[model samples]
Target: MGALLILAPFVPWGEFLSASIKNPGKYQRQKVVIDNKPEYKAAAGKVVNVNDLQTFPPNSNWVISYPSSGDSTLDAADADTFTKYELIRLPAELGGDMKDASAFVAFNKVCVHLWCSPNYNPAEGHKQYECPCHGSAYRLPDGLATAGPAAIQPPPTNAMPILILTADNDGALNIEPPVWEVNRNGVLGMGRALYQDGKVNVYKEAG
Candidate 1:
């Protein structure tokens, strides 16, 4: 039990963002609990019907926050305790041809260019995730920077970090805690540690 003592201070971070909370659009941290676990589960499994995803119409996004209980020092400030996920549904060509070929996809909401929340836009048949700060547009499903200054930026890792999801036998979708930084190969190792510690559980089997 002594080894488990280290897990105490490292509890799941953040509380649920209230509907009345100002700047709901702003980026912040929140606690994400596993489903039916007494605590909140962020927004995972919130979509009662996976098929209802299509009803959102194209170029729209469903934003949800999950507890990134692990340290995100490599991506954000060490004190910054949460990672937000931006959810959207697109065509098969965009979202990595998943198991069910589900068009639903999730991405780190922080824009690689200056970290503004990107919005969904579909005008003149051009669908893209557009960042408001500098007019950066990342191609949908894959979150690749196809247009905008982000494409020309020096960070070299322009694609937004993606969230990989797995569905349960009951059709509930769960987001796999990201363990690596996308496009940079830098590892977000803390995420996996938290899962193993039982401090976090993104899915039942993994918990």
Candidate 2:
């Protein structure tokens, strides 16, 4: 018998965005993007400049790299993490479900296939992120699998892991720790276990 196909019903952008915002664990405030070798640093209360991403233009993306040396389970060489996020400004008339013209969305840098980092490919006005390892393509704005083996059979999850983000008036964005890992049927799995109320914990960004 063929494998069962699971599909998640249409999920509004607002609903997914809101759940992440309301339940995200604590985040350390810092300037996510900066200049120099490290290119990022920890700060008490720093606001990120969203305008810095404008250089990539709408439909394009900026790759954010950060260090992650504290984890002992990870390989010794795996000392950094990456996330690709895009900012798009579409006219209301052409907008699908994205309510805001300036929409921001992000996903794990690791490709579900071989864990290779996917690169943004804005071709013919369509925004997509394609994996270099096996030519798998994930649709932008939602991170759904669109092509290649990653979208077909033999893959665990077609959709990419989404990072929930919330921004402040100053344009600084904070990431919620709990990641929503989408499955083949569009269902979600917890990237990490969550803590209950009254048990204090610090959610640190891997990058």
Candidate 3:
């Protein structure tokens, strides 16, 4: 038999090798796209402003970059330990108002492929996410990678987790961690949700 075709995300390294080597034509391959939907209240999560993403709210589930360094051009490996952070909520305005459109940004803290951590490079046009290991690129605006070696095509499920956000009474915004991963069936794998008490919930984003 010939080699089997493998897709991405669900086509984990192990599965691809097995199918391609032993069981050719046993499994069909597909692609999964990262969902960069704006994290909002109910429908979809609102997007985080690029600037506001630098800071953290008073009280929320958002993970803040440790020892943040404002250097945008910083690479993933050189981003300093503090440059990477997870967010639960963000302020409507960086220091002014949410209407500025430059207040927040949304991105996956995880890699599109094996869920690895990505590196940031401002020199590459304010790059928010990139996998140094496989060259998978991700846009911070919505955690969507325009190009890279993720899967020849996008994953069937939300390759990149969606960061849904909401503002609290104190005008502070909060977001849940990612709770879904791609499965063998090319469908969204429900994981522990940030909003509820389930094993995996798609309502929240990941860390």
Candidate 4:
């Protein structure tokens, strides 16, 4: 079989501050075996050999390199730690409220502003999207700034993947036929990418 890869663990891009890691840190790419399958975690910058691995209970919904194997026993270039934050995707159907498919534009699941991980919280009968740090909130119906420090509205095509599904008689949700995989990371990883990669259309002057 060929290699099936799970890319880096993404955090919301901007939740953590820029000055967090000033000095260039060491990155060690580590190979992790999942269910007897070999996988890899690339380090932030360069290669390192960590003799030990460390784990911390995850406060956020996504999982990161936790209590992994090869703790201080082995090292690789994958271990160079970088603060990579990305958004999480959740699927929901049109729910009969919309009349056309064009009602939404499925973005690559990457938030343009700061790449802070996006989360879904149903509030006031509308989806309330949130970033955990600094209290940035957006209206789910439209990625408009409801109340937060965001300079401008995040485009509707960024925070979500177009979803179509139907509920079975037993209440199990089923995606009809084809399913697509996306790397919202395609455009840029986060604010870091935006700044480094020169994607300027993202943050327009909020009038």
Q: By summed lDDT, which 10 consecutive residues of candidate 3 come out lowest?
A: 184-193
lDDT of 1 by residue, 56-157 (tens): 333445554455433332222222313555556565456423433255666666666555677667565667788786677877655667776665543324
Report RMSD (Å) for each prediction in the order shown: 14.7, 11.3, 14.6, 17.2
Candidate 4 achieves a global lDDT of 0.29
Task: Write the number of the candidate with greater TM-score, choosing between 1 and 2.
Answer: 1
Candidate 3 per-residue lDDT over residues 99-126, each given as its tens digit? 2322334344555455556555544344
44: Cα error in model 1, Å: 12
Relative to the true structure, how large is the alpha-carbon lDDT of every model? 0.45, 0.43, 0.36, 0.29
TM-score of each: 0.53, 0.51, 0.41, 0.28
The true-versus-predicted C-alpha distance at residue 32 of model 1, in Å, is: 10
lDDT of 1 at 45: 28
Q: What is the Å distance of residue 84 in model 1 from its true position?
A: 2.1
Distance from true location, Cα of 33 in model 1, Å: 11
Per-residue lDDT of model 4, residues 1-207, tens digit only: 111111222444343233223322222222221111123233221111122112101111121221233432232223322222111122234221222222222222233344445554544454556666435565433344455444233332233322232333433222222122222222232221122244432431111
- Candidate 3 residues lying further than 4 Å off, grouped into runs, are 1-102, 176-207
Backbone clashes for every candidate come to: 3, 1, 42, 34
Candidate 4 is scored at a TM of 0.28
